[model samples]
Target: MRLALAQINPLVGDLAGNGERILAACRQAASRGADLVLTPELSLWGYPPRDLLLQPTRLTRQQEVLEAMVQELARTMPELALLVGIAEPKGGGQLPNLFNAVALVEAAGWRVVARKLLLPTYDVFDEQRYFLPGDAAAVLELERRGQRWRLGLTICEDLWVEEELQGHRLAGPDPVAALLPSRVDLLLNLSASPFGQAKVPLRHALARRAARRLNCPVVYVNQVGGNDELVFDGASFVVEACGELACQLACCTEDLKTWSPGRHPAPGPPADAVLPEPLEQLFRALVLGVRDYAGKCGFQRALLGLSGGIDSALVAVIATAALGAEQVRALLMPSPWSSSGATDDALALAGRLGLITHTLPITGLMAGFDTALTPALGQPPSGLTAENLQSRIRGTLLMAVANQQGRLLLSTGNKSELAVGYCTLYGDMNGGLAVIGDVYKTSVFTLAAWLDSPAALPCRRSLGLPERGELIGAAIRHKPPSAELRPDQRDTDSLPDYGELDPLLRALVEERRSQRELVAEGTDPELAERVSTLLRRAEFKRRQAPPVLKVSGHAFDSGWRMPIAAG
Candidate 1:
């Protein structure tokens, strides 16, 4: 039987939009003469419906939409068998829990034949808060093209059999392992997996091992698009029974794939060109994430303050790539101490990329703040207080534009700066979303190098635009990185060089190492102590920081929450 895996992107509460997307995929598959189609988990109401599931009426509305989708499928494509996911309500002292269920659609109607047996509750997942465990195995018996196929259905956490071998299986029985005894010919798993820096490799290995062990072809469909701060990279695939890859879907997109049981019965390297660098992959994902977030949040344009520095420059590149030049706007908000070269760079980059640029000097805004504070202090301040005032002025101007024009304000701050509490809280930190908040300073430099090189950069998905040579001009790369909040300032003045600081931060923040442990790993005792102190004191600041995409195993979210006095 010809099977189609629809790697789709769905909105959280757009029930009609989600159903329409599923139907469109089924129609496309049927046109290609495929007998069956599969979509991502929770395609009906979108994954992680969160509190939307709390509304009793919302679930009823979802049910109505599902019934309508079934009727449409029965009338329009009777020969195609479509498997889609939704929240199934259980009865009899079930505490009104929802199930990650798969509904089989055919000419007769729809039946939720399989339910997920596992619920994950680690890191970012809080499934235990909403869903109850399903005790029954998910096995579906269907006939397609006069062939009887017993296909096992698994949700995102259902096919997590690797845990059993590793002794980490805590949620439920291994869903894939349970299928081996059923003598199934094929297995299908649906997922809404979140994106992480090193998650793709682990995903491939998981699917390959499962397919090899079951000795049956497995189709994996993953959800794509940005939901809040979580970006889902949909690099879905079809693996053959013997672990050969038959087909692969596009990354960071909504893609469709068709595969047959016996044809090319093994998964292979992804058909699409591999992302050349971690930065390129990350860039593409970030651009897509921002684009989808703004679009889905009902905003058409985004505005950010351009400080003529690398962080804002990189953010502009991502914004232009994601939302296009016309949809993004940048303002050069310079203070008296702001360098001429910074403004030159900002205008030159904007001109080269064809983005709308504006200038808003903070001289008047600074005067206003100083006047308001002069009453109690009797004089304008100097040093860190004055520097922060400039930042706050720029931030206030950006927010004004965002409020007036209905644009989403994008904050331009990197993880390195955020880690050390180098940024001004209400000043530069005022924005709706943090773009490169997950990226380190060294990684930013690497990304700049790749964007300038002719070769494809690592971690970037396609920008869907013509290449403009190197993204970051050579001068920007060669210049020393600085926030420019103070006069004649360089980053190294307040902190260690990026080369020294990034590794230590990675070890301490991402690896969760103690000061002693970091020092034992060859980190200087002085630097280690300083880094630990900064990380601790910054807890209050991080708590108020905007939502950032989690691209690493350890992101600065609840996933990596540290007590204020942990040190």
Candidate 2:
């Protein structure tokens, strides 16, 4: 049997659009002589539809969309069958009325084919909150070329039977192990797994492990495109019985590829030309993330304060690459204490990127704030309050520009600052989206160096950025990171050096390390305690901060859930 794996990008709640996407894929598959087409998990409603799932008209709309798709497929490609991921309403009277489901639609009509067993609640998955798990495994009898074939079907989390993923245990029924009794010839897993650093290897390992366990070839199809903070990298692939990769699709984009039961894939590492280097992958993910977020949120222009710091510089480059340089506007909100080099560096980076820069000096605004607050406070605002005042002024000005120009304001704070209470609330944390808020400060420097490296020039030029030496330049890279709120202000004064700080942050935030674990790993006990304390204290601020673009194993928003007032 020939299978068409459809990796499509869909808008959440766009039922008609999503159905059309599936029908179109099926038509194309039929044109290419494929017997059946498989789409990503929740392809019809789009994955993680969030509160959209709770709408009263959801089931009605779903029925209407499915009927439309079946009719369209019957009219357009009568012979082709489509396996589409959909939300099946299991009826009301329970807290959850849905099952994460897939339906098989052909010329006759559509019926729920397979229901997901495991409802993952960890990290970005909140499936258990909205879905009731299926009690039994599914094995379908598919026919092609007048021959019978047995196929096992599973959803995203059902395939994640890994005992340990980065030491995080996902306790669930082993879908592959259960499928052994079903005696399926081929296994199909539909996923909407988002991108993370070194995540591909883990995903590949899981697929290989599953195929090895089942002793049958596995077909995996994942959703592609940026949906809010999550960027689904659809590098869907097929692994043969012996766990050798037979077929693979493209990553970070909409792709469709075909495979047959017995035919070996084109060999040679499943097209390395499209699978980018890790640095390049991160860059591309951020670019796609920004582009999709802006467009989806109905913004044509993106604006950010260019502080001449590394965070702002990196974000500017990404924004320029995502939206054209013509659409990305920069504001250099220099304060009284802002160094001349900082101003110069911001201008130089903006010039290199060909972005329109507006030099909005905040000196007058700073003095105005001081005068207005002096009477209320009985004295001039100084120290932390003074520093925050500067940030708030810049934030206000940036908001003004964003509002006037109708540009989405991009927040430039990195994960390190956000980890601790180093950022000013309603200040530097202001924006529509926090681009690198999930990226560690150490990783920020590493990415900057990678961007300047010769390997990045090709991807850079292709993205329409400067193809020459040092797109970020040396000054921005070498400069000590500062908020420039006061004289000679350095981030190190408040927080540890990024080299020392980032590891602890990752271990604590991403790895979920303990005080004992940190000490065992040779981390200073006091430093560990201090950093952990800061992380907890900053929860309220993070709750109020803009949504962060998740690139690491764990990010602040949906994944990192903590009670604000709890001990």
Candidate 3:
């Protein structure tokens, strides 16, 4: 029996569009002479429908759409059976709780065989509030290739993580473990797993082990493309019953792979597919993520202040790559402390990239604020206070354009700045989405280097960027990182260099190491103490910060919730 895995991407809540995508994939799969095609978890409506599951009418609409999809599948491909993940209705007085259910449709009709037994409660998932746990395992029997095949079905979270602190004994058996007793011909697991910096290899290893332990061939299908704040890099593959990878699909793109039950698995690299360079992957992930988020959230264009510094320049480059040059408008909001080179660099970049940018000199606006506050605030604030005002004015001007043109404002601050409260609140912090808020300052330079290389590593979408060009070289590099808000400004003049700071931050914030522990790891005692202090002080700011892309094991979002008080 040939089973096709349609590893695909779907925009949340776009029922008609998602249906079209499913139809296209199923047609391609049918053309390959596959008996059955399986899509990722919730491929019909997208993953984690969140509050939409709470609305009764939304569920009704989803049900209607599913019936339509089944009718279309039955008519279009009578020989091919299709499996799709969707929200199934539970006939109870309960608040219309959601279920991760799958529909098995053939020439006859559709039947829901499996529903997710486990509901994830932690780490960006709040399934318990909306979903009711299922009670039974599913095994669908079908005739394929003149042989009777029994398929064990499971959803995304079913394969990972054991049940913890179960209150009732009637939660049924673990799905993967239960499949052993069912003795199915194949185990199909559909997932919408989000991407992290070094997580792809780990998933492949887990799938391989699961197939071997279950004593059955495992067909793993993962959702691809970007969903708001999340990018699912679909590197879906199959593992033979003997623990060898059979067929593999492309990463970060829509793809398919067909596998037969008896064939020996194809050998590849030790870690499944060869991963792209870190910078290339991150750049593609960010661009695709931003494009989808903006496009899905009902926005067409984006606007941001191009300070001509590394951060803003990178944002402009990425924005142009994401939404096209015409859709991206850059504003060079220079102040009294800004250098001529900074302005020149901004204009030069805008010209090179075919972006229309306005040189909005904020010097006049700064003078007005200074004059207005001089009497009441006593001769204008100095140091951090004055520097922050410049950022605020630039943010205000950018927001004005954003409001006028209905463009989403892009914020240009990296993780290093955000870590130590170096960014101004409501200033550079004003944005609907933060593109590179999770990226470290050092990694930013690395990405620029990748983009400037002759052999441009395969990126998802065309960037329209020069093959070999230094976006930020020694002049921008030699100078200490700065906000350029004050005279002779240097970022190190206030905080530690990013090289010294990022490690300390990882140790403290991500690794959850104490100040004493961080100091012992070759981190300066004074610097560690300072970083700890800044983290504590910046809690309020981060609390109000926009949602950042989660790329690391310990991304600073709701994932790494920290207490305000210092130990």
Candidate 4:
């Protein structure tokens, strides 16, 4: 059978819109003579519909949409069959009376063909709270040309059962193993997995393992687009049982491809099987995150404070690429402490990117704040208070511009600073989205350098970035990391050098390593203790920060739920 994998971008909670999107893909698949079409998990309502699943009206509307799809298919293409992911209501008195399900829609009608066996509760997922896990593996038998084919169906987390490969395993039924007795001809996994460092390779490894065990070719279809803080990279592919890639789709964008199981030789990776370089993948992911976040939130433009620091410079580049230079505006809020060289670099970088910039100096605003607060404080704000006052002034100005212009303010703080409470609350932390709050300061430098290098030309062109020369410019790329909130201030003055700090932060935040363990692993004893204390102390600030576009495995977003009052 010719199977078409629909890698689509769905808006969350838009049942009618998502249904239309699915029908469009079905039409494309039908034109290609595909007998069957597959969409990602929760394709109808998008992944992690969250509390939208709780509303009775949406549930009723879901049935209406599904029936409408059935009629449209019967009227248009009677011979084609499609698998659509949905939330199937289970009647009775159970609390979570719904199953994360897949409905097979043909000319006759639709039926729930497969229910997700694994309900992942970790990370950004909380499927267990809304879904009742299925008890058995699902096999859909199809008869085409008088020949019966048994196809195994698994949802996103069902195929993520390889503990050794994934380093950790969710405790549940092994969906892949359950399919062994059925002797299925093909294994299909419908997923909405988010993009993370090396996640594509891990998915490949899991699928390859399942293919070998089930002794059948595996087709993986994933949802693409940024939904809130999560960005899905639709690098879908088909893998042969012999552990060779048969076909691969595009990354960080919507795609559709059809492939028959035994069409090609199982010798080597296909031309499209080669993944993009790691940096390219990362860059594309961030761009997609920003684009979808702003677009979904009804923002036509984005605003950010460009202080000539590496963090803001990198954010400016990403915002320009995501929304176009015309849609991205930079506010250069310089203070008395701001250096002329730094301001010059910010302007130069903006020129290269063709970004609209407004230099709103805050020196006068700083003076006004001091005068207004001296009576209440009995003394003018000084030291750290003075530095933070500058940041708050710039943030207020940026917010006012964003409010007046109806633009989304993008926060430019890095993960390293957020981890240590180095960022000011309601100051630099103000934004609609944290574009790089999940990225380390060191990674910011790396990304900036890569943007300037020649290797990024193709990706740059794809994103509508300037491909001829350096986009970020060398002056900003090589500048020392600073906030420019105080005179002669450097990031290292408050925190450890990022070269030494990022590794520790990674271990503490991502790996969940203890302070004792860090010291045991040869980290400086006092440094580890200090970093750990700071990480804990920063929980309240992180809790109040903007929704960070999550790129790493562990981000200070919905997943990091540390108690604000805890020691």
lDDT of each: 0.81, 0.88, 0.78, 0.92
- Which of the two, 3 or 4, has more TM-score? 4
lDDT of 4 by residue, 1-567 (tens): 899999999999999999999999999999999999999999999987999999989999999999999999999989999999999999888789999999999889999999999999998999889999998999999986567899999999999998899999999889999999999999999999999999999999999999999999999999999999999999999999988889899999999999887676656788778778999999999999999999988998999988887888899989998999999999998888889999998898899889989998887889998999999999999999998888888889989999999999999999999999999987999999999999998898899889889889888998898888887788887777788777788888888999999999999999998999988879999999889999999898998999999999999998888899985
Candidate 2: residue pairs that collide: none
**What TM-score does structure 4 among the candidates reach?**
0.99
Regions more than 4 Å wrong, model 1 = 92-96, 163-171, 265-277, 457-466, 563-567
Model 2, C-alpha of 370: deviation from truth (Å): 1.3
Clashes of 2: 0
Q: Candidate 2: where are CA atoms >4 Å away?
A: 164-168, 265-267, 272-274
RMSD of 2: 1.5
Worst 10 residues of 3 by lDDT: 162-171
User: What is candidate 2's local distance difference test score?
Assistant: 0.88
Residue range 258-311, candidate 3, lDDT tens digits: 777886544663344455766666777788777878888889999988876788
Question: Of the pair 2 and 3, which is ahead by TM-score?
Answer: 2
> What TM-score would every model get versus the actual structure?
0.94, 0.97, 0.92, 0.99
Per-candidate clash tally: 19, 0, 0, 0
**Model 4 stretches astray by more than 4 angstroms:** none
